[model samples]
Target: MKLIIAGATGFVAQELIRQSLRHPDIKSVVALARRPVAAPPGAGADGSKLKSVVVKDYDDYPEEVRRELAGADACIWTVAITPSKSKRLPFEEVTRVCQTSTLAALEALHEAGVGRPFRFLYMSGTAAERDQSKTPSWMPEYSLLRGETENRVLAFAAAHSTPSASAPPDFSACVAKAGLITHSYASSLFALGLRLAMGVPSVRLEEVAAAMLQQVTTAHGFEKEPLQNEDLVRIGRRALGEGRA
Candidate 1:
């Protein structure tokens, strides 16, 4: 499979890229980043790895960047400023960058002439609840905005799958809402306790990457709602041949 990974520098995205290289079925990867993404110096020992595309702006990618998108089978979109980072910027800028950038990337895919069933995996957050109308007061804007984007992506997928006479070629999208990522051993310990006590899944980064790849390669159809962390863990483990926990 040929794949495109947006936000290639992200923690989870990098793991996906690394694992994809090891999968015999994956033929090529286009790692798109705001800056150049370099292959590990000795990465070829396993298999052919990623082709990096560096652009100054995700929304205004250059023609050369567009050219690299040809013949792509799947796109894993992992772009988003974290809530902490969003707090530093004006909320308007955060929304525009997060929402508009997604549209631009989808437009680029359409313009590149990608075929039907071209999978697009959106890395969203578990906090984007289904009830956008009843958003919490503390961070209502972020929740609603992200939730709204999820709806838009689902709509886009529906429209693309059944293009009109003049509509551009497009693809399907599935949103994966990953839970709180614990980067440290302590965090992992906490996550394990949560999993055992509440049965709420908190994904390991590798697990999330695995699930994203699974959805990309053979998503039966677009899912209108987000795939929560527990869903990710279950789906990912199945893909990895570990079965369910």
Candidate 2:
């Protein structure tokens, strides 16, 4: 099966790309990003299956980019400005990167056509609240924006769900609401500090990547519409132990 990893340069997406290249089921891996992406080290012989597709802008899908994405089996979207980074730019820019680009890609990919039951896993944060009426206690505006994007993605998929299966192609979308994504390089103290400040649970980077890969590839379908941090931890641990992801 072919898998597309958007925002390939991200720390989490890098891990997913590495794992996907090595996985037996994922025959081809497409790395889509603003800049060129090289197959990560340690992917072994299977690394040859990886291909990088550069896009000048995520919101614009020219013929070249669309052709590369044609007939894709699944896509994991990781593009979004983090809360910390959002503060550096105007909120408009943040929403465009986090929300607009996502919908644009979704529409473009669907228009380009895809394999049956096209699976899309959107990477969202635990703090995001879909209910715009109820403002979150933390980063209310940003959280709401992310949440709104999630709802849009779900709506897009539902429009092409099984009932309308051939709205040309079938569609399914799942959201991964992660918390602090800790990695091996970070000091435990720093990770703990962020968890406390953010007031959200944490999951290892490898675990999140592995869990998401399993969801789109090995699992029957999404384990849940929105896989939470704990769900990611559990599935990732199991996949790692089984040595499949």
Candidate 3:
């Protein structure tokens, strides 16, 4: 399968790129980044499967860029400014990076004319509010904005859903609502405490990447959208086990 990974320099994207190279089913991986992406550690043997596409801006995809993205089977969109990171920039800039860029990429891909049943896995957060009307006290505005973005993605999926069995499914999208991501064993204790005390979810960075790769590589369609932390954990664990086989 041919896969496209946006924001390839990010932590999760790097993991996805690494795993895609190792996966026997994945034939090619397109790493879309603002700058050239280096091969992940241990990728020396499988470097031929990976290609890096550098773009000047996330929002703009010229014809040359589109040509590289053409015929992709799936895309994992990891581009976004996190809430904590958003505080450093103006709200407008944050919205542009977090939301506008997503829509732009979708447009570019559509224009590029990727294959039918194109799967798009968006990297969202657990705190994202689906109901934009009900504003929570904690980072309400930002959460709502993200929720709206998620809704837009879902709507896109709905519009592209196959109308009949005879017709091919044009596009499919799923959102991975990941929780607090921790990398070290020392942080596992804190993650567990947070999950038990506050009912918040946490997942390892590898788990998220594994789950996403599994989703795209499957021959069957995704059964669920907006995969929660537990869902990710389960899928990821299964994926990791499969990788070892």
Full ranking by lDDT:
2, 3, 1
- Cα RMSD (Å) per model? 4.1, 2.4, 1.7
Where in model 3 is the C-alpha error above 4 Å? 166-168
Instruction: State the lDDT of candidate 3 residue by residue for 1-245, as single tens digits.
Output: 88999999998898888888888888889999999997898655578989899999899999999999999999999999988888888999989988898989988998898877799999999989989779877788888888899999878767866676764456989899999887888778888999899888898888888998998878786748879889999999988987621
Q: Quote the lDDT for 42 in model 1.
A: 33
Candidate 3 minimal-lDDT segment of 10 residues: 160-169
In every candidate, how many clashes are there? 0, 0, 0
Model 1 clash number: 0
Total backbone collisions, model 3: 0
In model 1, which regions exceed 4 Å deviation? 40-47, 163-170, 190-201, 219-225, 242-245
The Cα RMSD of model 1 versus the native structure comes to 4.1
How good is model 3 by TM-score? 0.94
Please report how far candidate 2 places residue 135 from its true position, in Å. Answer: 0.9
Which is the winner by lDDT between candidate 1 and candidate 3? Answer: 3
Between which residue pairs do clashes occur in model 2? Answer: none
Q: List the residue pairs that clash in candidate 3.
A: none
